[model samples]
Target: MNTRDAKEILLLYRGTTDDSDPQFCAALDYAKSDPELGQWLREQTKCYDTIRTKLRGIEPPLGLSEKIVRSRPIPFPRIWSRVLQLAAAIVISASVTVLLMKWSERRNHSVAGAQEILVTGEVLDMTCYIAYNLSGPDHAECARVCIRNGLPVGIKAQDGKVYLLSGEPGHSVNAELADYAAKTVTIKGRQSVRDGFAQLQVEEIRKL
Candidate 1:
């Protein structure tokens, strides 16, 4: 199987110890032969483990799980596949809901994230922006330095909205930033919250 196909099938592996899954075996063997792919495979496993850990960390509201559990699972070709699909669907749904929630806050109140909206905002270093309200050319150099030093980057919309920027899906934040710091740019993304912080999972960015 090619790398793409192998990656999809391996999603079902779910840390299982069963060696009988031919698809998982094929993906492993392919990854083993390729240095870069092997590294990626390892990294993907680490990311999944981290996500599972965080999910466990969240203290659900009382009886939330019971309510969720009371909902019967629909028959799917595979339970794991259904779980993954449901997770993906939930993310999209949750993102939209969060965006709308933000919109409900105020007229042109941008202190919230937006989903599928084209917004014009000033790029800034997240830490500096929150602590000092710094942005634009005056802070551009400092922002770049801070970002390179591993500080988070974000954008501030005209309506006083702040959004922590992240890459879409599998992209790395650092790699995606690539020096758009402290500039006014337009972005299209899914506006979502992670750990209660606003995030723009950027799909597109255009300098304005």
Candidate 2:
């Protein structure tokens, strides 16, 4: 399977226990052999772990299930059965909404706390880089084309950290950076990280 296919399959992978499953096994094997895919897989797994930890920390309201059950008759009547189902659905929906709100708040808090950073790295188009591991001087022209076409831009730093680039509202840094594709450059920005993904709100960039 190709990296894209393997990535889709790996998304469903939970842990090493799934190693015995043939489909997951094949995808895992492919990722192991492909450095880019392997790095992506590791980052994905780390994000999953973080989400799981956050979920575990969320506690349900005391006796919520009991309260719901007690509100209905022990032997639910036929007419009330459907009503109970609807109530249960609403309760679940409300719980999920609250959880999502909390998650959003956490993400926003991270962004609010983002610090300014200056990094030197190669300018690259995120699309081809992530999909096919394309980068460097040989891929310069193609990277330029992709960036000009509106694909997301990123930088692969000397330490191997990759940060997705963003610009001020109503502006795109793509036009200015397109010509520098696959070339080393220094960038200054506010770095926001969430779920193992990093993004840079670009303030300054200079080709090195």
Candidate 3:
């Protein structure tokens, strides 16, 4: 398979635990021989590791599981019990997949030989914009909340293309641009495109 194909499949990969899945195994093998894809996979794996670490640190409320069990109105038949167990497993899997997609934040890199360019567009809170086509004045407040809470931000150009926004190394542009969500703005930055993903490392931003 090609690098793009491998990347699309690997996005669902849940680290080494998914090693036994044939699709994931094939993607992993392709990634190994491709330097750029390998680097991306490593980054994605690191992001997943960070999420896992944070999840492990969370402590559920005491007696929560017991309370939930007790709150059940009636015990189910064996078949119903099996169905409920299967449902729960499906829910957990779906939740993990959503989390994986939502939190796969890319690190800002200083691209050598990248030239500065100016782009004018409406600021965007990427998650909702990408998932639901949510944008414009009505969605601005929600966009601000999402961006302030660490979701990635972008700018949708007049031609309808979106460029993800970033900041200097070790800094995130989310905080600085949260207030600008859905507003027309102009940004001066260095643009980098890899694997069809475009990111703008903002040097200056001003509302239009």
Top lDDT hit:
3
Cα TM-score per model: 0.43, 0.47, 0.52
- Candidate 2 lDDT, tens digit per residue, 1-208? 8987786677556566567998798899899899988876775565335434444566779987678678974576656865675455435533433443243334333344579999899997775566446689866776776566445788999999998777775577888898999999999988987666587878899767
RMSD of each: 13.4, 16.1, 12.1
Q: TM-score of model 2 relative to the true fold?
A: 0.47
Q: Model 1 residue 106 lDDT?
A: 24
Q: Looking at candidate 2, what is the lDDT of residue 101? A: 27
Question: What C-alpha lDDT values do all the predictions have?
Answer: 0.60, 0.70, 0.72
Worst 10 residues of 2 by lDDT: 96-105
Ordering by TM-score:
3, 2, 1
Each candidate's clash count: 1, 0, 0
lDDT of 1 by residue, 143-188 (tens): 6655553346677898988887766443446545638787778988
Q: After superposition, how far is residue 168 of candidate 1 from its true place, in Å?
A: 3.0
Off by over 4 Å in 3: 1-105
- CA lDDT, candidate 3, residue 106: 46
Greater-TM-score candidate between 1 and 2: 2
Q: What residue pairs are clashing in model 3?
A: none
